[model samples]
Target chain A: MLTPLTVALAVAALALAAWCGHAAYRDQPTKDWHFAGMAVVTALSVLQLVVGVVRLARGEEPADSTVIFVSYLVGVVCCMPAVGLLSLSERTRWGSLTVVAGAVVLAVLQVRLYDIWEGVGA
Target chain B: MPERNGDTDGSTGTARAAGTTGDGGRRLASGPGRLLVTLYGIFTVGAASRSLYQLSTRFDEAPLAYVLSAVAAVVYAFITVALVRGGEGARRAALACCGAELLGVLTVGTWTLVEPSAFPDATVWSDYGMGYLFIPLVLPVTGLLWLRRQPTDGSERTDTTSRTGTTGRTDGTGPAGR
Candidate 1:
């Protein structure tokens, strides 16, 4: 659950980042399709979050502190929606750039999530 | 590959923005300012939440680091608000805050370097924000430059014209309209 799910989520996140990066490069706003892409990544994160929370409920615990581990899990799920709302309000090239920032943050959070779960950097 | 239909009626982007402001014009939260706001908003949330969690759960482990993270979150929140407000007063406030933020980063960064034991846990500005890819160090400088480029009260018209004309150059890519 940990390794494969993190990989899938990080890949989805980076894919959204690349899509938004192209939009930023072309100096365009985040279009409907970009939102669609974010939706995909976000839905996957929601699934990941459910699985994580269920595991914790069942008696599974992360290698690190459960507090920060749960925080990272929750953080991944919120990133896309927050950026989506933000980019929607702006409606400019910077809006697309905002997506890029959010997606990159999401990706990095994925890595940190895995690290926290595995106690790699702890 | 190029999708150009990003704006609706695109004609009013620059003109509408320019006309709406009061005597002191030039929105700092325009083109690049939007990106800055997004980044700052993220940092505000991230740092604030992390610090609160750390302070609540493990105050005994590293009080100094958590306090610094809380301070970083406050500064980020201030800058995010200033950018979103988009007025002369807000711009100056952001500018002053950016300077203070840079000073904080430098002070914390050097202190951590000189005395690593003081920070058993990491603060946001530890070693110049290396934990966060040095973005904490770079962000203040970027905010400073962006705020400085904005037109103040008396120099509104000419500053707007010149910068908007060449804004794309400074921006790397994108229209001057924001």
Candidate 2:
């Protein structure tokens, strides 16, 4: 995984989480703007996924077991879209809160992915 | 008061009945329950996949820990499904699962602490889910509280309805609508 891209994704996820959490506290459902924000995060995740795969295809091995790293990579990629769809079904402040939770999870997963990648060489 | 009564009676009777029986009542995936379901779903996936990978790849390293992780994953999956299905039966099942989850976490946590060598690696509940931000420790407690708050039988519904009526009479709009 690209270190800079991973760090960027974590920051974006947390920032979006905080934003959604504020919206939830204000008793607002996930608005269009929230979807847009999620889209940006999801786009970043997709980019990471593509870059990781491309690098792997070109003989770049992760620091650890390829299975575990690949699993986490897929997980990070899928997290936002799943949570976003789930939140869409809910039309209350809790929906926004769900987005916040999803973002937080995504951020954590990204950090884990980074650690796993780094763990192999160090 | 009469207007509020008429409105609730006309519109919400089915909703109330469904909520009570889980036949057609409010879905467990509705409102705040939605949030709970989402969290449970995440844990279900996380625990299940993690355990599967560990058990398949390195079972010899820590058999006990991997088994416990698998158990935790199953419990999480059951609870998630029960919460989503809703109804009295599902609620009871969820409550039971939550209770079991709490018991498991406490038991495993204390066991690991009292005998650190017992777990060479870590189960999901080892150290009360420290690796997972203690969510495994807190989640069951929250599940129990949320389940307890759900109206169970007819009597509870009547009690809530009466309370709604009293508030509606005084305020001219039932507080329950929101």
Candidate 3:
């Protein structure tokens, strides 16, 4: 895994989570700005996905189970979009809260991916 | 839909009736319940995939742990579906699932703490879901609370009557009364 990219994704996800958390606490619905923030995070994840696939093509395999590593890579890319759609349907403070939860989950997944990758390489 | 129906007198009575059913039972996916559903959905996917992968690839290493994870996945999936499909029956089913989930988490959590050697690997509820920020432990508690807040079967009549009274009086105010 790309260490810098993973760290960047985790940081971005957590920042978005905190922002959405504050909005939810204030009883606000998810706004266009929230979507924009999500887009940025999703873009980062997509980039990571592309880079990860390229690395795999170059025969740079993680030390752990390749299946698990691939699954996490794909899952990291899917998380934001899925949560964004779910939040869009909700249209309430709870919708914002959902985004907050999703972002935090993404951050956690990123950390886990890093750990798993490190485990294999080490 | 209720908001639109509240505009027409002809539809008001029917809409009010429907609203009573809705508000009384409180659609499991409404408001805060939506958040619960989303979280449960995440857990269902997370636990199910994790358990399935572990069971398929290395079950011999930790059969008990993988099996427990699979069980948690099934329970999460059931609760997620029940919450999304709101009704008297769905509410009851969700309530039962939440209760079972709470018990499972507590039991497994304590067992892991007491006999760490028993689990060669961590299940979803191990250490009270410490690995997942304890959300696994807290989820069922919140789910039970949310399910309890739904009007009971016996109290449906009273709930509908109270809801009808409020909606009936605020006809001109539109859906704002809701």
Native interface contacts kept by each candidate, as a fraction: 0.45, 0.38, 0.33
Q: Which stretches of candidate 2 lie over 4 Å from their true place?
A: A120-122, B1-25, B154-178
Q: Per-residue CA lDDT of candidate 1, range B2-26, in tens?
A: 5466455445454533545454433
lDDT of 2 by residue, A17-36 (tens): 99999877776666677889
- Residue ranges of candidate 1 with Cα displaced over 4 Å: B1-3, B6-20, B23-26, B154-178
Name the lDDT value of residue A111 in candidate 1: 85
Better of 1 and 2 by DockQ: 1
Mark the 10 consecutive residues where model 1 chain A has the least summed lDDT.
Answer: A86-95
Question: What TM-score does chain B alone reach in each candidate, compared with the true chain B?
Answer: 0.79, 0.73, 0.74
Tens digits of lDDT, candidate 3, A1-122: 89999999999999999998977766666677788999999999999988888988899887777788889989988888988887776655677788998999999989888877778332
lDDT of 3 by residue, B1-178 (tens): 1121112222432343334553445456756777899899999999999999999999999899999999999999999998887777888889899999999999999999999999999999999999889999999988987776665442343332112111323223222212
Per-residue lDDT of model 1, residues A36-98, tens digit only: 999999998888889988889999988888888788878888899988877776666677788
By DockQ, the best candidate is 1
